[model samples]
Target: MGFSTDAIHAGQEPDPATGAVSVPIYQTSTYAQTELGRDKGFDYARSINPTRLALERSLAALEGGKSAFAFSSGMAAITTVMMLLKAGDHVISSANTYGGTYRLFVHIFQQFGISFSFVDTSRTEQIRHALRPETRLVYVETPTNPMMEITDLEAVVVICRERNLISVCDNTFMSPFLQRPLALGFDIVVHSTTKFINGHSDSVGGAIITARPEHGERIGFAQNSAGAILGPMDSFLVLRGIKTLGVRMQRHDANGRALAALLADHPRVGQVYYPGLPDHPGHEIAVRQMDGFGAMIALDLGSLEAARAFLNGLRIFTLAESLGGVESLACHPASMTHAAVPQEDRQRMGLTDGLARLSVGIEDLEDLEEDVERGLAAMKS
Candidate 1:
């Protein structure tokens, strides 16, 4: 079936028991055993839930992966993937990764004996140069969080194959609809379903999809052992959200192009970070790897004072931390999302206090443009 078809129906057959169109949320803690030891496929809620399994199957088909596992949040999904490695293993990741990811690696994982190297994954050579004998995985975030930097996924995958390294891509920003790293030979794809997959801002969830069967089994084990699985309600919500993924993303891409253009032309806006822009450094590679230039955009206003004025002026765009929601949101990355990173490191990546990341929604272009204009207008004050 096609992408949209799979999004709506993969692993989402009508309920076998009731013929209901929607996958029923198996909210029970455990299933009853019919015999001394044998039971239905599901034994415990933590190990498996019908609703969450449906979501995992749907996401796996969408991402072209062998299987997928859903978790309580995006971070939980990531932490489980990291569990595949031993304590002494090392990882190389994109320098401009999401603030929470950076914090998890440096502050949490490092204390556990795992080491990490941050580099500009857009420049594959930096990733190559950072490799050490202990390095076991390369984690990348293309069109990276507020910077909107794109990495050459094909190139990185090639390098990983040569080095026998496990390759993971955070598909949170682009979602599977926009980019499928697994198709490009990535071993694993991770997502914050809180973002695009769920589309709505109502749920917090994460997913890990594996291209190879071995990785799938290992991740499945970790998912069950760690027990941070997505609850049935959130799973059902994501399933509902994905049925319209194709259509929603079309509006998001359209609005992103329109807004990026508006901000670029605005006199007060200093710099805009969006791959859809032809002049953006990663445009060529992004064109090759992505289905669309998603709705996320970052604006550099040159100072915190200017950013504040601009944010204050917006009526439709709420100031918030998360992205990829149906409603528009604006956030100051330096203080809100990337605050966990040291100021020096944030500066090195050009994530300044003046940088505002916009999670452009599926709203009317004219309304969004007017709201942004209001923001720019306030900067003059």
Candidate 2:
């Protein structure tokens, strides 16, 4: 089946019991057993849920993985992945990873004796140089948050395979509709389903899709042990949202290109960070790996005051932190998304105080352009 067909139909068959067109939310906490030991596959909601299982199946199919596990939030999903390693394990990560991930590693995981090395994974050589005997995993975010740096996944995969290291890619920005890291040989792919997979911004959830059965088993174990499973209602929501992912992502890609062009050409804008842009350093690599450039774009206004003026001036685009919603959102990374990282680290990653990250939505291009113009006009003032 085609991508759109799979999006709408994979793991979304009519209800076997009721023949309902939509997958019903299995809302019960526990299923009644036929006898003491004989029962359905589901025993408990936290460990197994029909609605959540449907979502996992759909996402696993979408990502071309062996299986997927849904979590209460993106952080929970990431935390579970971290559980795959022991205390002495080390991780190599992108320097411009999301602030929340950075915070999780530095504050929480470090306390558990796990160590990390943040490097510019866009430079595959850096990843190689940072490897240690204790290195067990490579956590990467291509077209990395706000900075929009693209990592060469094929190269990273080769390095990890040679070193016998687990390779995990955060597919939140591109979504499975745009990029499938598993196809690129990544051992695992993670998503903040709160973003593109649930494109409406109405729900918050996360997912981990494993290419290998071993990863699926371990992540599933951690998910059950931690009991951070996504609720049935949220699972249903994400499943519904994914049905329209193919169509939504197409519109997102189109609008993203238009917005990136507008920002790059604007006199007020400086250093537009979009892999879709022809002049962008990662454009070629992105073209080689991704089906389409996504809607996330970042630009520099030169100072914190200017960024504030631009954000406050926008009318259509909401000033918010999260992205990948149907309605556009603009965020200041230095203060909003990456603020958890120290100022020095953010600076080293090229995330300046003046940077503004835009989550281009499915809104009409002309309206979004006008709103951006309004922000630029305010910046000038």
Candidate 3:
């Protein structure tokens, strides 16, 4: 089946008992057992829930992976993937990454004896130089958070495969609609379903999908052991959100590209960073790997004062931290999402105080443009 059909029908069937079209939420914590050793499909919610299982299966199919595991949050999914590596193992990660992910690696993971080295994965030589003898994984977020910088997935995958290292890509920004990392030879794909997958911004969830059965097993073990699985209600919500993913993504791409074009031509904007832009450094790679340019865009306002003025002046775009919602949101990475990173390091990664990340919504093009214009005018004043 095609992507749209899969989005609507995959892992979703009319409830056999009630004939309901939507997947029913099984809210129980435990299932009834006929015998001490046996139960009816489920033993415990922590181990497995019918609703959550359906969502997982749907995501796995969408991403073209063998299996998928849903988590309480994006960090939970990431932590589970990290748990696959033991103490003394090292990870080579993209220098520009999600702030929360960076904190997990630099702070929390180190406490657990795991180490990491950050490098610009866009450059093959940089990635090669960052790898250590004990490196077990190459982690990256392409079209990286706030910056929208693209990494060459094919190059990184080849390098990791040759070095016997796991290749994991965060597909949150592009989601399954725009890019499928597994099909591009990535060993594992991760998503913060709180964003695009959920589409509506109503739930917080995450998932990990993998083509390899062993990798799935490792993540599954960690998921069950850690007991950070998504709740049945949240799972149902995510499933509902995913049903319209293809449709929503079409609008997101159109709005994002249109906004990026406008920002690039604006006089007040110092620079616009979006893979959809022809002049963008990673446009070619993005065209090769993704079906659409995606909904995320970043702009440099020239200074912190200008950024603050633009953000505060915008009436239509909400000033908030999260992205990928149906409603437009604008945030400063230096203060909102990537604040955890040291100011010096964030500057090095191009996440300056003047940087503004916008998640373009499905709003009308004219309205969005006018909203952005108002903000730009504020910066001038």
Candidate 4:
């Protein structure tokens, strides 16, 4: 089946017992057992839930992964994957990554005896140079958060294969609709379902999909043991939201590209960072890898003061930390998302104080352009 039809009907069937169309939320903590240590299909909620299983099955199929695991939040999913590594294992990650992920690598993982090195993954040579003898994994977020940096997945996969390193890609920005990293040779794909996958801004959840059964088993053990599984209600909501992902993504792509073009011509905008823009540094690579340019755009206002003014002036686009929701959001990555990374490191990656990351919504293009114009004008004022 094609993507749109799969989005709506995959892993979803009429309820066998009640004949209900929607997947019912199995909210109980524990399931009835016929004998000690023997339960019906589910032994406990932590081990599994019907609603979450439906979401997992659907997402796994969508991403072309062997298995899928859902978590309470994106960070939970990330932490679980990190747990698969031993204390002494080493990880090499893209320098321009989500702030929380950066902190996890720099601070939390270090305390556990694991070490990490950050490098620009877009440069294949830099990635090759950064790999150490102990490097167990190479983590990357293509069209990276805030900066819109594009890493060549095929190149990275070749390097990883040569070094026998696990390759993980965070697919939140483009979602599976725009890019499927697994198809490009990534071992694992992670998503913050609170974003595009959920679409409605109604749930905070995360998912990890892997092409290898061994990797899935390792992550699954950590997910169940750590107990960060998504609840049944949230799972059901996400599943419903994903049904319209194809339609919503089309609108998002249209609005994002239009906004990028508008901002590129605006006097107040110093620079626009979007894969859709032909002049963008990553445009060629993005065109080669992705089906669409995706719904995220970033603009530089030339100064922190101008950025603040623009964000405060926006009326329709809410100033928020999260992205990829149906409603538009504007975020200051220097302060909101990448604030945890040291100032020097952020500057090197082009996450300047004046950078404003916009998650273009499915709103009408005219309204969004007008709204952005207001912000641009305010920046000039």
Candidate that would win on lDDT = 2
Worst 10 residues of 4 by lDDT: 8-17
Where model 4 places Cα greater than 4 Å from the true spot, the runs are none
Q: Write the residue-wise lDDT of candidate 2 on 1-381 in tens digits.
A: 788898888989887889998999988899999899988787889999989998999999999999999999999999999999999999999989999999999999999999999999999999999999999999999879989999999999999999999999999999988999999999999889999999999999999999999989989999999999999999999999999999999999999999999899988898999999999999999999999999999999999999999999999999998999999999999998998999999988789999999999999999999999999999855
* Residue-level lDDT tens digits of model 1 in 1-381: 888999889999998879999999888889998897898787889998899999999999999999999999999999999998989999999999999999999989999999999999999999989999999999999989989999999999999999999999999989888999999999999999999999999999999999999999999999989899999999999999999988999899999999999898888888899999999999999999999999999999999999999998999999998999899999999989999999999999999889999999999999999999999988864
What is the C-alpha lDDT profile of model 3 across 239-266, one tens digit per residue? 9999999999999999999999999998
Clashes of each: 0, 0, 0, 0
| TM-score, model 2 to reference | 0.99
TM-score of each: 0.99, 0.99, 0.99, 0.98
How do the residues 1-381 of candidate 4 rate in per-residue lDDT, one tens digit apiece? 999888878777776769889999988998889998787788889999888999998999889899999999999989888987898898999999999999988888899999888999888788888878999999999989988999999999999999899999999999889999999999999999999999989999999999999999999889898999999999999999999999999999989988999899987798899999999888899999999998899999988999999999898899999999999999999999989999999989888999999999998889888898888778655
Higher-lDDT candidate of 1 and 4: 1
After superposition, the stretches of candidate 2 with alpha carbons farther than 4 Å from their true spots are none
* Candidate achieving higher lDDT, 3 or 4: 3
Q: Which stretches of candidate 3 lie over 4 Å from their true place?
A: none
